[model samples]
Target: MSLRKKIADSEAVLNWVARRIAGYARRVYRNTKWQRVGFEELDRLADAGEPVVVVLWHQRLVMSPFLYPLDKGRICTITSAARAGSMVGRVQHLLGMDTIAMSSHKRHVALSREVLAMTKQGVSIGIAADGPRGPERVLSTVPLIWARTTGKRVFCMTYSVKHGREASSWDRMLLPRVWGNEGVFLCKEWPHQVPRKATEEQTEELRLSLEVAMNDLTAEADRMVGRAPWEPRAK
Candidate 1:
């Protein structure tokens, strides 16, 4: 009943707050002037009618929905089966995204199968590489596995703003101003490949390399928005 409790976004009631969260996201997205990078390639790829894996750090999740070309195809993201994930699903739904709400009871293979099926059905999969929790900004190899299996190249995108409030959370999530200056959304195609037969050691190395690449890409976006880069915490 306290003001502090009421003001916080609690996982227990996050689903209930989806509308307000989505509304605020839209206001910030539309009100800010965003310099977009690498979308022309995305536009072309979308027009080609095949799906690709879109990956971003969980901290930059705020404006991702708008980056999807809704008219060209459908895209979906996975969320935990926990109540917090349910809240994310609600917000994604409100923002015109399809969500695969993962069940805690399901086996890892089962979830991977479901994701593969979605890709086969022309659904683009979006992943927060360090999501559902974090070793913050660490790239998960599972998405790379899907990219290998489904033959979808990965595109990384992230954003930063000149006017925003950075959360005190582990990933330092930035909540951009609803109205103000500028921001930048930068995207790039990851040129690395995850070979189907790659050994565990190779995959692990690739993941670490990817973590650095994505962190640099994020830094570029932050710099574009006139801010210093946030260093990677996950090694």
Candidate 2:
């Protein structure tokens, strides 16, 4: 990446980045011919009438703001309390999302309570399953715990761009070009969760299941967009 790009992405320019992030995101969204594959059932949830938890990878955060409708359903997402996270929350706000800001290290019962309340109010929540800190694509148990505690279904969503640069970040973030490409691929039909009465072992089993499901979903999206199904590293 160029020094100019790195500087623009740095925390020093975070405020500037945050201000334009949503617009850039929308611009990218418009520029790409997005192909939605098998999102019909997921779309029925309304994100307002039947709130659910949407699990996404941290790497694809850029275009995530457009995953749900802007004028209809209520959508909420969590972000870290760190400086960079503030930018993320701001971007979501600019895209008309409600945010819960929490420190990754200390996210606890309080966060769960807030999420539960939001779910009850029909606000669909989006969680980056491997985020804040990550062993790249290694699924965190937080979303599983939320599913069990809130009695909400968990849905896996992913997208891939046919024209984009893969960032050198740990998660290999995709940076899309401004003009256009063959297409973008997206899907959110897979619904999974850990049961409320799940034992520790059962929870672990469910966690791995959801993790693989997300990886599989992402691979399918990539294939649809004309990209080889890339490896989703758990490391």
Candidate 3:
């Protein structure tokens, strides 16, 4: 066998092993202590024929799947081609979730198109605003971009555990105990009409509004779990 083929084979094996470890981790992590809040709004949104776009921080990506309504179908999650994402996609499939793998470099024209279609069909969509990779709890413009494109409200979601391990990864990845309490806050977006020549200032202001709303939701979740504002330290 050529050296390149051998290296490719080895890479494939390594990726497979990594995926197994992540899948195991996800199952074990969820079996611990877990609690949920603000789901009523989620169900209500679904009830009102308002297909929503759930925007959450990257750290809480795993928890997002479990927090979603089980009976509802037509839901889509935006993930990536990363190894961790591959693991997540597997778990989501097990839980009956439909996912769409997205690229950070190239925006998929189909993503917006599919989201609009799903919304029209009364299916919900979720975007890990700070994900596919991330800078911890920071917000991204993807959620806003989708909202502007699809004409749907963006539900800003966040969660924290009273006790658990916080991965040192970019998103400070959270592994909440099954007995831990989790909270979801909705930052509903009702986009205004923007001129074809919308100013950068206007765009920045909208983004800032989203950031503030999401941050407040995170803070509220912190309070629910009895912590200081914006401090997701695992106590």
> Which candidate tops lDDT?
1
Q: Deviation in angstroms for 16 in model 2? A: 1.8
Q: Candidate 3 lDDT (Cα, whole model)?
A: 0.65
Q: Which stretches of candidate 2 lie over 4 Å from their true place?
A: 1-13, 104-107, 232-235
Q: What is the C-alpha RMSD of each candidate to the true structure, in Å?
A: 3.5, 4.2, 4.8
lDDT of 1 by residue, 87-149 (tens): 778888889999987786888788888888888778888888988778788777767877888
Model 1 lDDT at residue 81: 70
TM-score of 3: 0.74
Candidate 3 Cα misplacement greater than 4 A, ranges: 1-35, 104-107, 178-198, 228-235
Q: Give a tens-digit lDDT track for model 3, residues 103-159.
A: 665567766676677778887777877676666555677776776777666677767
Candidate 1 vs candidate 3: the TM-score winner is 1
Candidate 2 has which clashing residue pairs, if any?
A: none
**TM-scores of the models, in the given order?**
0.89, 0.87, 0.74
Error of model 1, residue 16, in angstroms: 3.2
Ranking by TM-score: 1, 2, 3
Of the pair 2 and 3, which is ahead by TM-score? 2
Error of 2 at 110 (Å): 2.4
Global lDDT of each model?
0.82, 0.79, 0.65
Segments of candidate 1 deviating more than 4 angstroms: 1-14, 232-235
Arranged by lDDT with the best first, the candidates are 1, 2, 3
lDDT of 2 at 231: 74
